[model samples]
Target: MNEDLTHLTREELIAEVVKLRKGIRAHRDSTMHELCWHHPQLWNLLPEKTIPEIAVPAWPQFIRGCLRYRESLDTQLPDAPRVKKEFNDPDSPSNI
Candidate 1:
């Protein structure tokens, strides 16, 4: 991986961030789908609410918690795992 972002202009960096956010949303959607598929009873328990209503509200806090956990790990080991592109393919069997 090219560990250099210095070459990217500010606009380019912002664009990359947007792209990453989209990928994250897609991954989250796929995971939620798999969860619902595996646990139909859980879906029934929340019959009145759509999936977004059930999950979207918690996304921000969940992301913050993840960042905090990663930051703590990074303090111990400077070379922490960066978010790489994974789980974006909706047709993957693991996603289903």
Candidate 2:
């Protein structure tokens, strides 16, 4: 699959995200669970607010693969440090 992520317009980006969500759902159905389960990190690839819907049905192996792909992205964000921190401050949005 191609991973070229050009700057998409708002509508196009939303459409892309919707399509990806569909694909993730479909993938959850088509493959065995282990394909996504091995790596616990895959859950982090998705938006924190909406991840459960997309990930709940997916196999652990597939989730692991998804996480591997997410981490392997060309410009992915850094993983958080060992300690967990709250991010409810208005000034610092979670996206950053």
Candidate 3:
């Protein structure tokens, strides 16, 4: 991952910085629901192309994990505004 950048022109170095900033901005602007999904596009921005093996928890365990995460958010950002809008996932069977 430690590629020597000495060969790159000033313009090239600036272009790299610009590209990195754009990727960071995209991640920073993700919504609450969007944050729940995996972001391979963001990972692709890095020099490493290899995908790391991901371990998924079972449904019951995953739900418990989600609950704990939500609880942590409540503790961390207690003053954050709550959204009452229902999340309608168009592709979900329940929505159908």
Residue-by-residue lDDT tens digits, candidate 3, 18-67: 99899999988876667577888878877767977999999999999989
Model with the higher lDDT, candidate 1 or 3: 3
Pairing residues by index, what is the TM-score of model 2? Answer: 0.27
Could you tell me how far off, in angstroms, the CA of residue 34 lies in candidate 3 after the best superposition? 1.1
What ranges in model 1 sit over 4 Å off?
31-96
Error of 2 at 6 (Å): 5.0
Candidate 2 regions exceeding 4 Å error are 1-6, 31-96
Output the number of the lDDT-best candidate. Answer: 3
Q: Estimated TM-score per prediction?
A: 0.31, 0.27, 0.75
How would the candidate models be sorted by lDDT, starting from the highest? 3, 1, 2
Which residue pairs clash within candidate 3? none
| Candidate 3 local distance difference test against the native | 0.77
Candidate 2 lDDT by residue in tens digits, 10-74:
88778878877776775565322233344334454443434343435358876697777756643
